[model samples]
Target chain A: MKISAQEEYGLRCLVQLAALPDGASLTLPQIAEREGISTANAGKLMWLLNKAGFVHSTRGTKGGYSLQRPAEDIRLSEIIKVLDEDVLNKHCGSYTGVLDSCVHNGDCGIRPVIIGLHALVENALSQITLAQLVGNESSVDAMFHKVHSIHRTVEPHGV
Target chain B: MKISAQEEYGLRCLVQLAALPDGASLTLPQIAEREGISTANAGKLMWLLNKAGFVHSTRGTKGGYSLQRPAEDIRLSEIIKVLDEDVLNKHCGSYTGVLDSCVHNGDCGIRPVIIGLHALVENALSQITLAQLVGNESSVDAMFHKVHSIHRTVEPHGV
Candidate 1:
């Protein structure tokens, strides 16, 4: 599986928000200029994030765009789902085959793996709050290590 | 994130091989005809799988190609990794920025989450053997349940 460029840029946008002072927000022009993406593209991403409730816009001079919830409460899954929902949810059973339909259908073993992988990924994404993304270097390092150690512990054990 | 069409088709081709009788193999033409793909493309995938040791070819008149190892030992991670190695390894620390470079290379919070998710996906993939894809319905159902149960068990506990 591949992370789409849209997901990358959208997440980077959220990171920009997380980096701002507690109450400050970035205007559309400022975001586009800083990100080296065109204004139109930035606007599209903002609209998506906005529609998804991750962000909201203000109308006054002091207003622009800011996160709707605390950074710590925002999940990466939300950001990704907003931008690449279909990509993230491609179940194995849905694969169209070269024939009239997939020959495997309900019998494919890979289906469970894909579905299970999706669930695990969704779990990991939900657990990782935006707060973790804004943490200090040591804290972030600890988070990575925690995940890795868990992976190691899980691999050798069988059901 | 999205699984590439190449990864999907290649895996499907392997499934075709897995479904064959123990000593019987499909030739290049037969494989293409069965999968409804171009012969040249099917040949490319077969060559890659052969080089990777997943399949072997017979050079004689009655020979074609068959699995080199037992299907149960051929992990899905091996297949996905072979097809998506570069994508899987794209780290956040290496992300190019809109500016000359990222402002948070050494300390991005999202880096850990991506890496962790990658590990989890890898772990899940490695757990699934190719034999599962060709299993009976109940066996496949059990595989899905096992993965879900593992996810549930893992979520609340911290190391």
Candidate 2:
């Protein structure tokens, strides 16, 4: 299964906010320029994040958006849930349907297996907080280096 | 992160085969009827499963398909992988180049969290086998009963 662009962008935006000095806010335009996202899309993403209570936004000059809580308190699961993204494998007779039509139907023997899988995924996601992520600056830097290397390879020869 | 129709159908078909007596074969039509799937779709699903060495199909009159190995040996992960379906929250930066421009870039703190989630999902799926599913009838019965109840409630009044 794939995560949608909304979740991806939303998480990135949160990470950016987490990196800033405590209580500092960044305007949409500023964040957009720094992250290379279009200001329009950034505004939209920020709006959603604000609605989800992850960020608080202000409208006037010197107003922008800042995290509602410390980064360490926000779990990846909450971010994903707030984005309302579906993270399970969907199929006609799988867990998505009425309990009966599912291949396991009454007790069709595999319910535990699927449920266990769901729990494991949720648990893993819940364990990570924004604090842990921002704390590992070295790892994040290495990842950026990798991304840059890839970008250099993909750029047009003369550009 | 959704499971595709292929993986779901494939697992259902395997369970049907496992429920039968050892060495007893079932034709594509029988499987289609039992699982409420179209013959064409069954054929496609079977082709993949056959190629993966999960089942062996015979050629003419009285010919049919049967498990190539014991049901207990077949893991759900194997079926899903054969279909190129991954039940994990994949990052766009890891696969798509254009998305790397997202603000978090490589240093997005949440990457490790997502990676951990992916590993947990994979591990859970890997542990379930067809043998475990068919070993107990009660669980299967319960699943079907639950689905049936939901169907009854949702069905149109006249129908």
Candidate 3:
């Protein structure tokens, strides 16, 4: 499935926040301009992140948005969950015998498969912290390889 | 993200094939009826699966469709890839200042995130073969939980 625009923009903005120098904040307009999104859209995205407690806003001439805690304390999965609620609930197609009937029904065989997939994805996301996301590209690449290399290595033993 | 109808139906059909008794095949109409899909749609879905070398069919009236290999040898990743080609190539949003001028861009910060995610998902799916899909429900649940548990157990050791 394709990543939604909200996820892409919200995440890029978060990374921008993590990359910010000490005590610095970025305004909605600056975030939109740098992230290639509309100013109005930036305000909406910030509202979401702020509500999730992942971001904090200040008031006054120098006021803007900043991470509520150190980037190291934030989890990428938490940010993603706020930006896309459907990240966990997946709509697998119907499998009961009838399309929409008054009577006939049977076990929906495919639901478990989809559920399993969603769990696998959520689990993977939970393992990745924001520090890993905003880290150097080489380490990020290593994390990617890590997911592939580690899963099967111990599976043979008793996964 | 939602699992596509193609993924759901196609996978269900593959499980049906894997469940078939030795040398026994189910025709398109049989699969369509059993899976609650229309014959026309089932034909199209089968064509995709066949092209991926996951299924084979016979010509006579009694002849029908069956798994191309033992269910244990067929990977779920292969089936999912056949149903949804975009499983591997994710469209993480553009990062270049000029959104439409992406031709000049090298690598966007978000692409690796998506690529890593795709790899993570694929690796998880690769661990599961079709035999596991057609197994008992309890075992199916075990496989799902396995993905979540195995990923993080050893990453801290070296990853």
Candidate 4:
């Protein structure tokens, strides 16, 4: 199972917006630079986020994109869904069987098990908001920095 | 995220073995027939399960397979891992450069979020043992039966 770049970029874009001063709008280019994503891809992610009601955008030189609601109100699950990405494996079960030839016929023994997994993930993602992610950036940066330091120490000693 | 057929098949196979009379051995063909899976797939799945120490296979006439440990000792996570299928999404991060280059480094920001999701899923899957799923089959069957009956009743009523 894999989460595509779309979901990752989308969340980062949201977090970037959350990091901006309250009531301030940042253009796609600014977000792209800060988050280390491509301007075009950032724009695409923003368009989808806006369409999903997660953000509001304005056209023209003075206008740009901003959160439609408070950062805390936006759940990671919402972003994932809006990006049309699947964190769980989307096998035949989630599909509307073409020509009505689903192998399991909707009662596949494993369907409930996987669905339970999906629900658990959804619950966890829904609990994390843009506010939480942005607020914790410094901690994340510090952790990555520590990891990088450890890597340097271990690689030089080969221990 | 989606569960692979390997995991789904592996779990069902385990449940089937768990339901067997003590000390009884079941051949791959028998399992394939009962589970409505192809013999080749069943054999492949069983080989992986055996390699993971979940099952022991006998060779020669009347040879078959049996559980290596008690049903209660086998966790769903073990089965999934043995099957080499990830039960949750694991994104490395978003593409920092061109897609081809990103494929090499995989330093996407979303990777961390997905890793967190995987941990939660693994935790849940690890806590559920084969015994729980096997023992709950009766209740699950009853629930499905109820739903089936409801579907039958509603089918004729052109809603």
- In terms of DockQ, the best-performing candidate is 1
Cα TM-score per model? 0.79, 0.70, 0.75, 0.65
Per-residue lDDT of candidate 2, residues A62-112 (tens digit): 999999987778877688766754444333344565554444456455555
What TM-score does candidate 4 get on C-alpha atoms? 0.65
Which residue pairs clash in candidate 4?
A: A87-B1, A88-B1, A88-B2, A89-B1, A89-B2, B93-B108, B94-B108
What would the per-residue lDDT of candidate 4 be over residues B1-159, giving only the tens digit for each residue?
A: 455567778888887897788999899999998778899999998998898899999988999999999877777767877675442422332323234424324434445555555555555565566765654445333332332333233211111
CAPRI class assigned to model 1 = acceptable
Give lDDT: candidate 4, residue B108.
Answer: 41
Candidate 1 chain A: worst-modelled 10 consecutive residues by lDDT: A91-100
Q: List where candidate 1 sits over 4 angstroms from the true fold.
A: A33-38, A59-63, A88-103, A137-159, B33-36, B59-63, B90-104, B136-159
lDDT of 3 by residue, A11-49 (tens): 888887888887999998888887777899999999999
What part of the reference interface contacts, as a 0 to 1 fraction, does candidate 4 reproduce? 0.16
Chain A TM-score for candidate 3 is 0.79
lDDT per residue for candidate 1 within B1-159, as digits (tens), equals: 666767776787888788888887889888877766788998888888888889999987987888998887888889888876556545443433322356544545455555556666676666566766774534544544554554454332121
- Maximum-lDDT candidate: 3
Write out the backbone clash pairs for model 1. A109-B132, A109-B133, A133-B109
**DockQ each:** 0.36, 0.13, 0.34, 0.10
Residue B31, candidate 4: alpha-carbon lDDT: 90
What is the RMSD of candidate 2?
13.2
